[model samples]
Target: MTFAAQVAMFSKLAEEKGMVNSLEGNLSVIDRQTGNIYITPSHRAKCLLTEEEICIVNPQGEQIGGTGKKSSEFFLHEAAYKARPDVGAVVHCHTPYLSAYAFAYRDFETPKDTFLSQIFGNIKCLPYGAHGTHEIHQGIEEALDGRPVALLGGHGVVCVGEDLEDAIGIMEAAENYAKTIAIKHKLF
Candidate 1:
């Protein structure tokens, strides 16, 4: 599928999973062949995204192509891609359950749930960093050294994968994992 189609699909998925409310999350895909990156615009609702609103930027986070302002968290995407060549897409979302765990849990490894274990092997929590700041990007890079996903302390979750679908799947699995943990804790 085209990058725009993938972004739209993931955006809807984010909304369905309540990972984002209004315009809270962003999605990006990198063209491995061209070193180009396609991403959702800043401040646009994930559920209401459009092709024209997507921004295509270079690996350096420059506006090489596309419409609309790039996401303020573009550096986070850049850092992840730069750190992991296998990563084709990156998702940053305020998935409630995951975010809750991020603030509450210090070392949240893969959940006991089979689906979570299969999808997101483990979730590392990066130290708190200012949103959209260089510190946030740096924190992500350090946390993702060899991991596919990381939770930003008191902020949100970032998932990277070989493709957009995989990245989105990781995000979904993370939220489910967090929800399962919450339910289990309540039951105790």
Candidate 2:
């Protein structure tokens, strides 16, 4: 898919899944051919977003193109790319189910459900850090290891993948597992 289309797809996913508020969360993908990153704009409602609003950044985290402002948590995406050279896409979602685990400073215990196990082997929670800061980026990268998904303590969830679809799928899996865990916690 076109880079703009990819950005729009995941941005809509974030909204459709109720993973973000009006201006929350963000998604990004790196164009391997050009080494340029296309990301969602900060403070823009994903459902109403257009392709032109997606921001572009270089490998060095410098904004190189696009008219919209990069997401405020752009550093988080940058850190993921820097730490995992193989990661071509990153998604940060404020999905309530997953954010509950983070807000409670708890790890998302990998669910034993067959589907969850297959999707997220061990999505751990990162140590606490304030949002929009370098510390948050460091904590996320450290917790990420080589995994596709991790939680930002007291903040939200982050997922990295080979592309926008994979990243959004990871986020969806994280939310489902979080839902199962929440149910388990409530009943037991």
Indicate which candidate wins on TM-score: 2
Candidate 2 minimal-lDDT segment of 10 residues: 137-146
Task: Return the lDDT, model 1, position 22.
Answer: 57
TM-scores, one per candidate = 0.87, 0.90
- Model 1 misplaced stretches (Cα beyond 4 Å): 111-115, 139-142
Local error of candidate 2 at residue 96 (angstroms) = 1.5
| C-alpha lDDT of all candidate models, in order | 0.78, 0.81
| lDDT tens per residue, model 2, 1-188 | 77977898778877887876556788888887787889898888887778888898887778887778888888888888877788889989878887888888787667465767766777778877777777786565567776788888888888999988888877887787778778888999
Candidate 2 lDDT: 0.81
Worst-scoring 10-residue span by lDDT in model 1: 104-113
The residue-by-residue lDDT of candidate 1 on 1-188, one tens digit each, is: 77767776777777777776556888889888888888888777777777767788875668876677888888888878887887899988887788886787464676566765765666778877788887775566666767778888877888899887788777787677778888898998
